[model samples]
Target chain A: MASTMLRTSALRSTIRATPTVASKRARLAGVSFVRGKATLPDLPYDYGALEPAINGKIMELHHSKHHNTYVTSYNQAIEKLQEAQQAQDIAGQIALKPLINFHGGGHINHTLFWENLAPKNQGGGEPPSGSLSKAIDGSFGSLDAMKQKFNTALAGIQGSGWAWLVQDTQTGSISIKTYANQDPVVGQFRPILGIDAWEHAYYLQYQNRKAEYFSAVWDVVNWKAAEKRFK
Target chain B: MACNLTPLISPQALEPHISAQIMTLHHTKHHQTYITNLNAALGKLSTAVSTSDITTQVALQPAIRFNAGGHINHSLFWLNLSPPSSPDAKSSAAPQLTSAINKKWGDMETFKSAFNTQLLGIQGSGWGWLVKEEGKNDLRIMTTKDQDPVVEAGLVPVFGVDMWEHAYYLQYNNVKADYVKEIWSVINWKVAEERFLGAQKNAFGMLKASM
Candidate 1:
């Protein structure tokens, strides 16, 4: 059933611009909107897109397994939350909030992270452009300084967390911060660049030497997505 | 005043929008029901039931969690609410909580807008909360149904608006959403900041307490 949906979605992509009016309407509303939930998106590029910097094995585990776990948990939590809310079981609803945060966060962050990488030799490395470049320069002095600061902060993570280059909403200035576990940056900042520092993120590749993994991540840093976030 | 809890709203203070009679009944009768239910649930637990099994303990967690939650939530609600303030109180000097809201949300109005947006999304009996995400000091919206404590979600709830039927059923009847929309006028931002600061200081300890 899942593969059938994927096939039809792929077919819809191929016949773009000249789609049937009915299909276009369905597409505009989202095919999954009919069911009220969407399946996990397929990775845009191959698992090997970020090879060496992030091994194929890590990408495979991260996407197929870790991300899937979050997706499953998020769906289950949503169902439970809906049930609790319907019963006016405030206690039950409150009890399920952590599952929502942990699983919902996992779904959100990993979805962003997947699009934020590409093959090392592809359009991944290069400096950011336009206003994003200027913003980085304005906030952190230079691109290299921003990179060094982000890496340094990420490397210093005490335990499982994410190091992020985020935009401060009040000042409209870019800043870097880290979140313990799966907590998103929430209201104070909009995340522009994030590095997954969880042990599962890089333990197999770099072992205890997180610094090495942090250094390698720069090779495939998705500057384009970060640039879009700035604009 | 009826329950002997300190009420920030006096009888004369709520004269215009909410009659003193209703306020008295709400505080004395409706709020007491939640507290009574919670205590009854706690009192019924046998010693063996309390110590027997971890799964049983986790399962029974919600009775205490919710009733206590409802009591604490309603207590805050009574303190937060007031009759539509006269222009004098509305335009009074900005309090510390307004400044804190500025730090988190840019301004009081923006914060209220966001808070109301979240509150309206509470589909059934639950609460809309403005909480400081632990360690990050960021303001975020969280909805908890029934009696879930704000901290259980790993966010330190700074302020909460209860949307349970009992909270507004007498006044608003079936229109819970309208009640939620209207309640913003009476929010006591000063108290919210006090809660926020308190939560920030003790968040790490709270996390450890759960362990």
Candidate 2:
């Protein structure tokens, strides 16, 4: 009986959140983000703040353009997904998932991507302090050791993916993990830091050399921001 | 990459007791097909993302969810079996993984029996898993249907057993029970231990543990 109630509640939430095509389409035609739709987060600093490390052109493209595309597509997918559900189009909903995963992942990744970065002028590139720094030493032996291990793991990515510093649920210490494409760190592992390894992330400045990009991103890592996140 | 089809182990290691031909065909043919299928599924997922044709909810999600599950499950299945690492040893003993399992699940015999019993009870194609779940930091047993990962269940996978037919067909044919019994001989406890200790560390900092 309890399970049935839970299932009914789930079904109710699903129905309540069902998309209205009229509103969804109306919101999409506009350039601005809609409330309850996808909203473009405000940049903490000017677009050119993280110059040289992540250049103005890359930031402009990554944010105003690329992230916007994901936001638009995600809203559209959700709208269609709701319609499909309402119509009992099981086959249609099944088909729409990649868009949701990709675009939804795009939104998720970019949201973190923006906050994770900061200008070196504003204390970026600094290493973690306090318990985080100590934990880093304990797990990987030293800060440099952790960086080397992370770089090796990042460079080892065969294709487009993400390199992450994630909290292990059981151990409660940070560990470096890599995921191919947009596979999220997911579940209980809290993301302390993440570096995007997608070609678009560093293609303009570094060209094809991922290792160089991996090395360079360290300069604008926003360690102060990372330290704040650990708590 | 393509599954290393030629041969990974010597046939003579499991000989007389377990035939060389059976091991060869099982690893090279059956497991290889799963790898190929998994790759194909991933490729389809990529295509869906690129094309943007997935305008509905039902179209591409199932492919990504199901095929990714298939890939992960099959990959683990192939890694589960082996010939006894030493001649004098009990074929089923996995020295590397046993101590950790003992630490968590009481003792080797108990853990093995429980795991195999769960494996025997699976209603259909699914997996039997030993996962480490966090909450005071401990290992736990979890079973999942189809190809769903323990990670999705919010646990770190310590050990896994795939009950899918392709895993057992070449050797035991229709008799899954015999195949499950046979696989215990070659369990790689070493890799399992590494994963265990790694999970034991406050990895990625989400848990409340001291370094």
lDDT of each: 0.65, 0.64
Candidate 2's clash total is 30
Q: TM-score per model for chain B alone?
A: 0.70, 0.69
True-structure lDDT of candidate 2: 0.64
Model 2, first chain, TM-score of 0.81
Please write out the lDDT profile of model 2 over residues A1-231, one tens digit for every residue: 354334323422321233455457657875232325665555666788887788787787778876777778787898788778768899999998877777777677777766677778666688888988988889999988998999998875544578888887777889999876666667878777889876567755664455788888888886755665675
Q: What is the lDDT of residue A228 in candidate 2?
A: 54
Q: List clashing residue pairs in candidate 1.
A: A90-B145, A90-B146, A90-B147, A91-B147
Give lDDT tens digits, candidate 2, residues B1-211.
Answer: 3322334557556644346765555455544544565566556656766877576334555544554555555455434444565532352344545665678778877887888888975533568887766433466777776566555534566657777543454355445678678666766565455455555332222212111
Candidate 2 chain A, run of 10 with poorest lDDT: A8-17
